[model samples]
Target chain A: MPRGQPPLSLPALIYEPKVRGIIFQVLLLAALVVAAWSLASNVAVNLQRQNIASGFGFLDRTAGFEISQQLIDFKPTDNYGRAFVVGLLNTLLVAGLGIVFATILGFTVGVARLSSNWIVSRLALAFVEVVRNMPPLLTLFLVYFAAIKTLPGPRQSIELPLSSFLNVRGLYMPKPQWLDGSSTIVVAFIAGIIASMLLARWARQRQVATGQQVPIFWPSLGLVLGLPLLAFMIAGQPVAFEYPALKGFNFSGGMVVQPEFIALLFGLTVYTAAFIAEIVRAGISGVPKGQKEAAAALGLSAGQSMRLVVLPQAMRIVIPPLTNQFLNLTKNSSLAVAIGYPDLVSVFAGTVLNNTNQAIECILITMGVYLVLSIVTSIGMNMFNARMALVER
Target chain B: MDAGIRNRRIAITTAALLAVAAGPAMAQTKTLDTVKARGTLNCGVNTGLAGFSMPDDKGQWTGLDVDLCRAVAAAVFKDATKVKYVPLTAKERFTALQSGEVDMLSRNTTWTMSRDTSAGLSFVGVNYFDGQGFMVKKSLGLKSAKELDGATICVQTGTTTELNVTDFFRANKLNYKPVVFEKLDETVAAYNSGRCDAFTSDHSQLYSERLKSPKPDDNVVLPDVISKEPLGPAVRQGDSGWGNVVRWAHFAMVNAEELGVTSKTVDEMQASANPEIRRLLGKEGDFGKGMGLDNDWAYQIVKQVGNYGEAFDRNVGAGSRLNIARGQNALWTKGGLQYGMPIR
Candidate 1:
């Protein structure tokens, strides 16, 4: 109540919300810079005290370690940089395969769980309950130790139906050796594909214009299959089957899928599919019963209702979570280390880090790869989710 | 009012962060001080390498490397049991040592040029002299290492043995595939599953691993020692004073063996009239004090942990599961390469 000549105008300006927020932000930025600087200096001082050269210069050094299951042509004499590429490719390969297989298996199991049959739904329910309760790493251990270890030894490899042998070493199948004229067959098959696509377009237009159907499906199928056979006969059957024969203590002259790769793929797919199945079931159930009834009242068949009506809407609810499953499967591929699959973490971070003693660089690179992979997966998922989003009026 | 409190908080945090990093800039390093302050030495050993460092059912550690750790503990605290064991795999051993996760790494690590020069580590000295060799089934009808060309071999990953095997095959112009695993148990399982034709490791390790096979008698270890693997103890690259402590601790045991001292007789030898024996038992010289240890450091080490000869016999030599001969690990006087320096 004792009024001064100046009514505290400067304090009001200093204590403004906008100015306070700016000050807070600047202080935060300064704090972050200080923290980062101190951490970097700590690392530098430790490296100096230990006389360790810190940089990517060690990547040029000859990596004397051998990675067993490399996707690239990695040799013991290759540099450390090549080792990282090999590891990254292997990680991508397993993640890619795992996502494909898991989507198929998960959708199937989800449909089965939604079935009216008691036995089918119960079986699917049991599978999801058991697997969803267990850890992914434990599932990997079981697939590797219990399942893969029980396969027959190389000498007693089980004869599969398609010239493939199942054994403890791997699944060895016949390799197709292309003699001359194989390219002509492949070109003919591609021509058949183009012809089928054109026929589908023509049939659609004709049906729209004239009140008649062209019956294009059977003809397209015939062209796709028959053209390849016609080309093969014309080429005098240039493909020779080089079946895997037992030579010495192992199989020779064939394509072999190592047990480590199989175990990793199986474990990742099966474990991820359990959770994906639940997501899929929730999406399918989220479609109201009234929607299907409405389609039936419109004189649509059951299959037509599901394919043209229910699934499209259900997928709207399914896609965002499904994208999450895909990312989870990709990140979980790093668990291939447990089975010695030579994935990124195993080959690059585990072995290379130990051999070169460049832990910080190796770890940063590994984390960077995973971060980029995750971001790319999320971006792809976001694109799909946007496409499936509800349309605004 | 708010700015005053926030500024004070910021000052405290900055001070704390700077203080966290100010230790290394001091004139003298403090690895020994840290170990003493912690009261228990963190010793990294193999996860379960039988002769080197394996735990029994009672969780008591006993092996060559384990004994060395106890000797260091005895030398420091005069209490041999004052030690903590960190079980590390081949892939984790170097990092664990370099990061100071363990004060010393007494794992059976092979000393190599790359490991010493670039890996920020220093090999104390050779504790067990070993050589890389091959093991195969008797059913193969292969007699020599050279005859087993184009063979798939099982090897532990992140090891010098893998590089050695690759060099062996390349130098001989042979083709082969290597099946590598992270764990020794997994490597053995893959080999036993008929996934590989041969398993290769140090000769001492081959004997121990072969015993774990289903039919041990059906396998035969090849006689060729392809590479000289001087397996020894390693410490971090810095702290020369601590490195010297670990190195001389092992040397003291070897020297005691050369001086004909044992754990049972070390107390009696302390009353000897001989100058060399008196100096070694810390009666005449203050060498232990120069290393920042008590004058009776060697006495405690020998009295509690025994000499190097006893450790070798009970762990990997003739009295143990390995039953390896003292080819290069015997003392210098016994025509072996285990040369010891003068304790004085």
Candidate 2:
């Protein structure tokens, strides 16, 4: 009877539909847990032997290091937590500014790549071709070492427009001196923004009711610009300018933007714009050609057709990937360590880790920061994407 | 029937847990054993620190810290050249040591309380007793560091010297801006390009870096010594046996210098009637053996790498281009800080 039994089939188990997935998933979960536990215990023993303290208590100690740029009041005597805030703010500042500039440049280049003029298209193609193929670190080095290194020294700072000077130290610009009673002008600027929003809403409604389009663009700009100017004049121009004049060793009266910060910003912008340009080009190309023809058939000009029909659809495809570029730009800002820009990774993870010798704690904190930043960015972008998504009539 | 299978599963899981728990002991070899098995000492050093530890024109590493690495190798391997030099930056030096990337770290790093207690490093002994100083152009007509008010200072990032400069400027009630670069060469380049009015570092570093300036004579190190920076060779904290070898290697150099044992006179001094010299030259006692080394380990170190004074003058002091004074780095018998323990 036993000799007549069939042979065991091993591969037959995976073919069982319900049992198959559970077995695979259970095996994966067990493997992950075992691997993680082993790693944790190994790290624990190694850390104990090495005498490296593990925990976040190091964050509470005085940083005892000077930070060059801070948005809030900070000194060398401040705690490490404050130092981290300064670094995080700097990272956010660079990321925000870099996103704005990169998007503008990317969209411009992406459109130029499809330009009717051959030279324009070729130049755009060459720019993307050269920049995208290069590594970000090399771009940073080139900007810092080659480009910024060529700037004149402090003694022979090259003067620029708008009372600015370029030197090896940094770019120095006139500081805006907010005099007494400048609050009223700021209040009026806020009022101007609110009034424009209301006016646009009313105009949209008026068009829906009467089919008469109000000229909104120039009027909105004039309102915002004129309201601020009128307020400034009414308050007797409460903002003075302190121009940078060559003093002892540097320009004394104005602000000195560090070459490191500028170089990093330049590197991030140049590198990220290349990727974004491709995204934009793909997004625009994804829009069907018939849509442009439809806009033209409706008696719109070439620019109007593009603005009214193609760009709206293109943006739907463009935004999701554009958010990815923004995140990449944010993460790539960590390369500031190579150039010494004091970004979050460079300052909080690097200098503080060096000072405190708490690698695990510092790294976890840095990882947590980047995780939160990326998550928040993704959330905001998803919300924006949802708003622009198609809706059934 | 189910209980039998459950027992087997539990036994397997327990064994796996035990293996991982024993990982620290099983996975790592002590630096001493690794170095012996590898036959070449990995010595982490500065990439190029002029007088402290920089390569010569022939690409051979030569400097004060390089000599310390050689001295340790000689003590262990009886051959000075049996060392693999690992060039590291200021930020990387401590991490390299902590992670066991090098057997001994012979960089121009200062021995600070935080580094000792927090970074899991044990400094063997002070090899260079330096103080922070500044170098400013003579054309500025600045005679003293105190007069450097509102001066922009260029410094290497991730150095205690940077913090020292900050402390000094703040203590003196001076308003100074610090421009930091990631490497020493970059810092010097920035200074040379006149990005900053003055460059600050350990006094020895100032003298060495000034040589890189287009007009070395134009920049003068200020008379002020702002902070005490005792540079030394360091080893990881977990292995005292290895630490003892490194510590004694440094001490043997100083004791030889004090006992009048130069590299040339070492062999002859083994035959001397002087008790101290005899013990030092390994003519008496098993001092090196106590430290898990050969009886003639000190002799090997002296014969190969020279004593402290010879290393000092040849690499950084009067004999070299830096022309640094042996001010506080001299033997304690000559009224300096370096004093070796009695060999007995």
Candidate 3:
């Protein structure tokens, strides 16, 4: 239409960037749709032809089997769906505890690696190097075998204080049975926590208002412990100990911490902590040296400067990678199958799929669960990261 | 018009590529034909179940189940060595056969009704007559499974043993905990390390597993046969031709044992005038032809892998360290239940 411009045509339109981009995008979408449809149809036809039942309907059937470690109530007569829930809970238990333990150990060892004491730094270095290098599965096996091999039998269980027993089967401890009115103590503990939070906030505000510091640690501890103790006394000390004793073959009447669970937690925590330690070290190192120097110039001690200046800043960098380590620990808990821990993969994917012969359905469900777990973990860590992030005016 | 033509051409090419990416429409080929074309029989067996399907020190598999696979191979290829052994766990065995990863599964798998009907597996026939039992430490001095009231039992997961132990404990009103493991080695190791008070499995497996303990005599199998466990070979269902071939492979061995057609006497007995022996050795009728095999299928099976009696004795019976008696596994003529169908 313009003086020197050629008339718009189909050939010319194809060469245009906007038109080319749309065409390529549409073509790519079409290819993906076709591939996905073909794969699904292929699976369906194969499953039908093979006559192997493929659906989630089998979850309703009676499981007719037993699980060793259950965090919730379970029986052999439970349905497959309930068994799956039991497995999921066990997996969550191990992963949740593992994350907590690994974080504590990781932060400690990471800071120790930078300690001025040579022995402390070298020990931390050796721990991180050795554990991070070996395979998680091998470490699990070693820990499991060590527990199984070294521990004594129930008849000759090693005696521990407070009437606990350690044996090959497990660590049998005295379970605290709470009578009525235990709720009073629980309520007091919660109130103490709330009061301590309020006190710390007030103390922080007072310090900002007037350059004076309040001793929050001892007072907070006193409130927490004293409230709980007073509640227990007022409630007539409503707690009884159920000590485990050998009855027939194993210890009866008390809580038993299974070796399988202990080994799984130990293995996953140690292995995951090694990688987490490196992340922490990198995070701490990423903080500017100027921050520490400024704190010292203000007459703050090394410990105070580290606690007040460096770690807070380092946390922003540490959290994202630390989230990855947590997710990894969760996934690696699947290795519990090797040592007979009744985790999700061991129970649901391994046993249920085999019994039902519904591989596609069982595996799909297991993958979906892990996907959701990872997403939830990512969201939580991201929220925490947001809080620690530097705010701009 | 030229641009439109180019777009059409690109669409057609994309469709063609998509079709290629989606694997070829899997035509249901007869398993026999596929195995023949592949030139080796893919047989799934246990990872390591001694006296049943474990490999020897020389890496040569030698057991009752291994012999069954060899018998099928001998019948098809005329050479017992033309077999690819795929070691599978108890959990992996059925899926391996169902997926057609293996043409035949000769693992010591129990032939349950559910496996036969819904799981899409055709268990050919029982190769080992087994029953669930428990093995406990002799120091525990447990005489019978009844004494295992409050015990913790170690069992391999994905097995009928898990169910049987539960039922046994529940029926007897005994409280027990089950420590289940994925692999047989793990279960046995847990049992040996005193992690469990008892290890329960098929009776034959109990004897075999006891040998794995550091001191075999320190433990003993309790006098308990809780549930019927007829361990056998299985193949994918819906292939009647393939099913018949595997079925008769086992039947041929049993019939040979019944008719006294030992591997040593198979050749000489073929010349004997006994009609039963003649028909069995494939001299009278073309029984193998019905199953798409040579007429001398039974002869080859006998010559290569020996009869059922020899296999039992050599693997799990008195000749082996397991020393399991032929109790209910004996031929029907000898007051046992192993009755083979007539070849004719």
Candidate 4:
């Protein structure tokens, strides 16, 4: 419209920013395709020259090597596919246990850092600072070498509070042995959970409609826990505990946790908890102090004010960072290789690759598993964060 | 509008040109020639395994395996110092060789069939004969390996020792659990702390561990050989010329010892009346030249590091702290397993 402006041509219309963006993206995509094609051809040529065969058919072959520690039933004669499962389960076991313990320790230390007692707060702060600075591998070595190795032998095991035993070999504890009718108890427990959920929903609706709240917590707890016990009693209480008994040279008739698993779990939990504590501390501090004061102004007790008002808001900020720590813990489980825990990376990536001489395929599968796990975790955490986010009209 | 169209065309053409140029660059190959032209041999050694490959207090490597690495360097450049020792562990060693990070691996590596064929590596020859054995504390009163039926064994994670221990226990119908560690030091430490009932590894390694332990005489290696471990040197499979250079380097040492050409008498042997001794000392013929090495390549190796027997006796045999008798590692003339091929 201006006088100095020249008329735009048809080609200029096609080359506008919006149009150019599409063209640029297409070009980038084409370049990527070409690069990939060339890389594939180069690999083909190299493989031919080196006489190296590349395929996933090796997964069907027998993995002749025996795993030192396996959760699932496995033998050297088992297929490579079975070995993969063994590795996956081992990884999940470590990550799952590490997550549970790290969260507990993290929350306690985080709150203690804000404690009224001077010594407690200082000690929590010192732990966080010291652990966060050291490498996870070093921490693992310290625990495995200095801490666990110092334990007494089987003959001189340290008796814990319970009938549990701790020795240099491993932790020996009483394991639950399920007899007949245990399935009935399990079924009843599931039914109890469903009943509790339905009851809670009904109580919420009733409270909203009549402005008269029902004491749902106690009733729900009773239904969920009491029903299971009632079912067990009616079914003749079929489950029993097998306490570990010391034999001549070793413990027998109970579950034994290997030192490798303990060291890995201990290392991961301590390392990840330091980061989680920082996240928790930051989350609590981020909540405006006015929220707590507001709850107090409403005549709420200190405990109720913090729990009902502060924690809800703090958790909203904490869940996202806490999720990140979870992902980190999962990845760090690969370090179990250092202690020879037979996790996915050590068993599948390291041992399997060595035996099969299929480094590319093995490493790809290992990385792919990790990538899928991370993606799933992130998606799950994002869904949780969305649910906790504040709604504004 | 025309200029805009022209610019777009130019951009597309440039990308296409780059894509075309990348094909040739990616397909290029000449790794073998590059190694030869470099003159200096890249040799992989074990990091700090005593009697195999360990750095001295003065930062120089000294051991039988380290000597093998130097021998290869001497064959290549007529100077034993022209070697760069890339210390590698068991897990990293094969990958390093296959990836061309090291020209040859002279570490105390077991020469297995799978590694020879599947790993794209060629074992030239066996340098030492080793076997897996158990080492336990003297106070345990475990005189024989068979005495401990349910003993927890501390073993290094990735080695033949792991498989051997399992087979031994399985065959004996004994129930034993292994407490595996990635590093030798950690495994030994675990064993010393009584975390494990016994430590299973190569007999040579057990000997080394005993020396490094807090109380050297407090532990003893059991008199049981669990597995056959033919430790040797290896090179990449594709290059026959490079493989010969490495293989002959080892053989030269063995031949020198068999001919009684010690480091002290190598110079005198060069002028000997015996034809075979003269030829071996690089005085009569160009035998070394045929193998792409200097005539005096073997002379340099012996002069710098001594023969194979000397290196063995000094590091791991009767003369060392290990006090291991050369039962199978002795020469053929001495009625032992080490019967090397003739140089000619």
Q: In terms of TM-score, how similar is model 4 to the real structure? A: 0.91
Clashing pairs for model 1 are none
For candidate 1, what is the DockQ? Answer: 0.31
DockQ of each: 0.31, 0.25, 0.35, 0.23
Colliding residue pairs in candidate 4: none
B-chain TM-score of model 2: 0.91
* Alpha-carbon deviation at B280 in model 1, angstroms: 1.0
Can you write out model 1's per-residue Cα lDDT over B85-121, one digit (the tens) per residue? 9877787777667656688999888999888887778
Worst 10 residues of 2 chain B by lDDT: B1-10
Best by DockQ: 3
Per-residue lDDT for A283-367 in model 1, tens only? 8899999999999999989888987888888898889889889989988898776677889988887778777777677877898
Q: How well is candidate 4 docked (DockQ)?
A: 0.23
Residue A351 lDDT in model 4?
A: 69
CA displacement after TM-score superposition, residue B340 of candidate 4 (Å)? 2.4
Clash pairs (backbone) in predicted model 3: none
The lDDT of model 4 is: 0.80
Off by over 4 Å in 4: A1-14, A210-221, B1-36
Give the B-chain TM-score of model 1. 0.91
The runs of at least 3 residues in candidate 1 whose Cα sits more than 4 Å from the true structure, single-residue gaps closed, are A1-23, A179-181, A184-238, B1-28
| Candidate 2 C-alpha error for residue A146, in Å | 4.3
Write the residue-wise lDDT of candidate 2 on B195-296 in tens digits: 678999999889888887789989998999999999999998878889888888989999999888999999888889998987887788888788767889
How good is the docking of model 4, by CAPRI class? acceptable
